[model samples]
Target: MSQIVVLDTNVLLHDPQAIFAYPKDEIVIPAIVLEEIDSKKRLADELGRNARSVSRLLDKIKEEGKLHSGIKLPNGSIIRVELNHRNFTQVQDLFGEITNDHRIIAVAMNYHVEQQALPEQERKQVVLVSKDVLMRIKADVLGLPAKDYISDPHLQADDRYNGYFTLHVHPSIIDEFYTYRYLMVHNLGLRHQLNPHEFVILKDELGTTKSALLKVNANATKLEPLFLSNDPVWGITARNAQQRMALELLMNDEIPLVTLTGKAGTGKTLLALAAGLLKVEDEHKYKKLLIARPVVPMGKDIGYLPGEKEEKLRPWMQPIYDNLEYLFDTKKSGDIDKILMGLGSIHVEALTYIRGRSIPGQFIIIDEAQNLTSHEIKTIVSRVGEGSKIVLVGDPEQIDHPYLDSMSNGLTYVVERFKQEGISGHIALEKGERSKLAQLAADLL
Candidate 1:
């Protein structure tokens, strides 16, 4: 059965094509939604893009018929823009205010009341959908069926990468760790189900003789490198269990998308850049190393950022340069730039130019991915061509987007959805590895 759904302003602002999201259903946009869109049209960043998109969508719909009446969408759905009417009194009675959200709720309430007058089977179909939790709650209080927009239907946190494994070995293997330089457990042979970034602690047949940790790559090759970095490159190293797992994920080429979460100074960016450099410059796994982060401000854009493309990107990409300089032990800022130029294969770009472009044979890293909407993230990830590995690193808890929470942020959503797929992998780095004070702050404050 098709449902009658009234989209609140937040839903429209969050996804301009929300009308088409509910296929085969009647979509209604309250008049107040337009007013709210108008107020936000002049803003900047994703919200502004949505406002403009909504305007364009409504304009395209208007070509079909008068919006106050009804129009048929190309997807075989009906859409109508609601106008004030006597039915609105029921809304006023319920909300007792003409606030914008309430006004939009009024349109949905009127639609529900109209449905109630229909046949019994038809009366169970109207729902008011909004991205705003408070508005959804208010709709329920007013006796109207409501739901939040389902941006991600597949999310499983319990199945996320835990980064540990167990290997059952013969009791004789106990001597292998201390006596032999390495162990080739030929008995475990090829086709073993160890994932690319998986780590294992080999235990004796008696389970008490000796134990040594090992890592498995995609080729099913086992390498038992030192468990920790001895030189402590870039003044950063795994400081906690979560961070140690995160390091394993970052260093492993098999795990394409490594998701890290922590407060500031967790060394997320530093570690990601270091691993990217190692793979691109040292290992030659990819043609290039690409780094990009969303340009979204907390509430708005920087208005008119000065200079050319590289100059304009400096303010935002400066943090990356700082990390690179620290990693390379370069005293001059230009020294890091010279090194990047000498490398020639590495490139830093802005996210704005990434859309619709196919990037193949590259190690792509997206920082601050939590700032992106699910749709935006889809657009970015879909651009990954053959032989390309894209890593999305972000802290879900620090979302600047108004409509996204930790659960809905692109990083968390991707981690939850792809954790089960063997081709994809995720790790939630919980510990701060930047410094003693930084780690202390991440835990205490």
Candidate 2:
């Protein structure tokens, strides 16, 4: 049976194209939800962009038919605007409030009641879809079916690809890998399929220390030796196997996109910056090194603090500057700035200014990428032009975006979507290589 899906304002703001997500089902828009979207359409952020998109979508749909009655969607769904459900007495009796959320709930409740009055075979399931946790709880309290809008149905944080795996094999296979530098994947008799560029640690079947690090080739048919580097990059060397795997991906010009995910002290940013510098300055593979990060506030907007754009961004971008200073080995206060000014090959800016610009022949690193929505990440990636490499580094467990979590954030989304592509690579750093105190805090605290 077809079901009625009532969308909340937050769902539209989260994804403007959500109206078409459900095929062959009825989509109902509460009158109050449109009002809330209209109020947010003027803001200067991702929310405003999404709101305007929703407005355009609704306007286009309006041309099809009258929304008050019902409009046939391209996916065989029926969309209608519930303007007559403005009576909020039911919600007022339940929560004693006339807020927009209550009004939306009242619309769903009214529809549900009307549907229940029909014969059992003629009744359709009335469900409320929202991104707000509290709203879903309230719908449950009022005996209404509600669900969170999930953009990626198959994603789970615990099941994310860790970029590498360990397989215990016969000791002779490890010796053959060292001697020949390649092994046929079919000979391993593996149970799980290996993704392209995925790392593998071959240990002896006896559980001894005899091992070799290998990466699956792009064809997934052969295991090749890792490109291990002994030289220091900007005075930093790989501290662990995960870091080495990340460096291999970052320095490879063939791989246009790389994702590095880990905890706070796992050196994701440092490794990305170091490889970007090596490619830009030493190899001269690109014109410049550009580092940009989302300017997400921890608690409140940085605009509330008094200053100009640069001044306000200093606090949020300080972590980026700190990594640069360490790479440059700046002793004095202004040494890092002087080095950056003299080289004139490195640019640091907020992610807000990167849209609609074609970035070419540059190495770009986006830090704190977990705070970005999937759409925001798409906008950023779409800006990459010819001969440019983009690295997205973040700790998914430390997202600041209100609507994004570990499984749904842009960084994880990109990792999952691009893992199969030959030009993309991902590594989830497991060890914290910072100072012992910082590592301890990350683990225990």
Q: Give the TM-scores of the predictions, in the order they appear.
A: 0.70, 0.92
Q: Write the per-residue lDDT of candidate 2 for residues 1-445, one digit (tens) a residue.
A: 8999999999999888899988999999998889999999999888999899999999999999999999999999999988997777777988996888998999999899999999999999999999888999999998999998878767665789899988888999999999999999999888888888999988899978999899988878999997756567777899899999999898888889999999988999999999999889988999999999998887778778678998888788889999999998889987888899999999999898787899999999999999999989999999999999999999999978877778778998899998888888899998999889989999999
lDDT of 1 at 242: 53
lDDT of 1 by residue, 1-445 (tens): 8888888888888878777887788888888788889988998567888999999988998998998888988898889988863355766776676777777877788778878899897574779998788898988888888987766545444544544556677767646655764555454653545555555667787757577666554454554544455334335666655566666777666566666655677767877787778778877888998999888765435457777888878887787788788888898648988998998987887788687799998888898898888778888888888877888877776887788776667777676666545556555556565778888876788
Best by TM-score: 2
Query: What value does the lDDT take at residue 416 in candidate 2?
Result: 93
What lDDT would each prediction earn against the true structure?
0.74, 0.90
* Model 2 regions lying over 4 Å from their true place: 87-90, 116-119, 299-305
lDDT of 2 at 140: 94
lDDT of 2 at 393: 95
Best by lDDT: 2
Give the per-residue Cα lDDT of candidate 2 at 143: 91
Model 2 clash pairs are none
